[model samples]
Target: MTARALQRMIHVGCRELGLDADTRRDLQLVATGKASMAEMSEAELAKLLEALKARGFKPGFKPGVEPGAKGRRPAAPRPDLRYIHVLWGLLGKAGALKKPGRDGLNAFLRTRFEGKWGSVPIDIDALRDAGQINDVTRALKDMCRRAGVDT
Candidate 1:
């Protein structure tokens, strides 16, 4: 793979593992070609994933795992997404933003999202940097369905 492609892959992998802020920032630098992914050792990557697993952030296939003709189909309709319906709907209303607006989303998130997670959000740029906006959209739809939202 091209170095750029590999860097992108590494970026996605790091995010999937719920990396801490500093590590995620460093990886993002590498991903954007400002730094080098080769600087990190394979051992470091393995250890990071181990820690993620311990935190209940196990990485698996896309949420929907379909069977062949004889078995049950995958439950998810849009398995490629990230985040969830609330974010999806909120962000959708603010489409085509190059970066999330400073005030708009924050206000909604603070109010509507407060008690749901019992905390504020972390860097939203993490999701934007994934470069899979459509997949994230699809994933949110599937999430809504799975959550029994009458989708």
Candidate 2:
């Protein structure tokens, strides 16, 4: 990571850990022997991030993806459909899927559904048959399992 990105992550960590100004300064001093981020090198910033993570500061979002952008949750309303989305996300994260998100999943579903049922739903939510839904879920779960990704 760049120095700027590391510094940004450290600041985000401070907010996530709920550290007050004084406590943050103290921690910085302890970790890098410096109180200001500007004075610390990139390595020092990473060390501080590790300390913050050890103190239970989990990062909430990825660097490029903004908040409320496409994520694990798709627009499908049903719980079972959402579970399919979650499995798709796991495959995407594992780099098993060539494309990710609703469009990719939709395209894959179209091919599979049309081949078996001779027609495809307009979207995942349009899949009304319970058997079809179960088939898609089983397919996604099998893909995840094959990719070494937990469902």
Candidate 3:
């Protein structure tokens, strides 16, 4: 995971634990090897998480798990048509795609999923019927990350 993601997890854990500033600082020092949580290596971040968990600070969600979707089971590992639509909307809002229609989406997909583009239709209905939704979802997420917008 990225350092920023690790830091976010740590902050969320601290908040849930109701840790005071001083205690938080000490934990940060122990976990990150610095007073601040900035620029921590992956190993250090793992250490920090372990320390916090040992201190009874259970994070609301595990690392790599997206937040929200309360009271529902975690989403399936495979991407479905509905998930593709959700990702499409998110990418559009993030300004990663130029326009909002099939043409614009297809253009974006062409750049990322070159090999699969010829088979995948631009029309959402056609794409769904083709059963290439998983590939599209994966490409959309990759594009979002490359565009520096969290998926």
Q: List RMSD in Å for every model shown.
A: 19.1, 11.2, 13.4
lDDT score for residue 145 of model 1: 58
Candidate with top TM-score is 2
Give the alpha-carbon lDDT of every model: 0.46, 0.85, 0.69
Q: Can you write out model 1's per-residue Cα lDDT over 11-111, one digit (the tens) per residue? A: 55566665766776554454343334455455444444444445444354432343333343233233332233345544445453233444444454456
TM-score of 2: 0.51
Model 2 weakest 10-residue run by lDDT: 66-75
List clashing residue pairs in candidate 1.
81-139
List TM-scores for all candidates, in order: 0.25, 0.51, 0.38
Q: Model 3 clash pairs?
A: none
Report the alpha-carbon TM-score of model 3 versus the true structure: 0.38
lDDT of 2 by residue, 1-151 (tens): 9999988888888876778889999999998899998998888999999989899777876545777787555467788887888888889999998888788989999987788989888778777788998999999988888889976
Estimate candidate 1's alpha-carbon lDDT, on a 0 to 1 scale.
0.46
Q: Which 10-residue window in model 1 sums to the lowest lDDT?
A: 73-82
The alpha-carbon lDDT assigned to residue 76 of candidate 3 equals 32
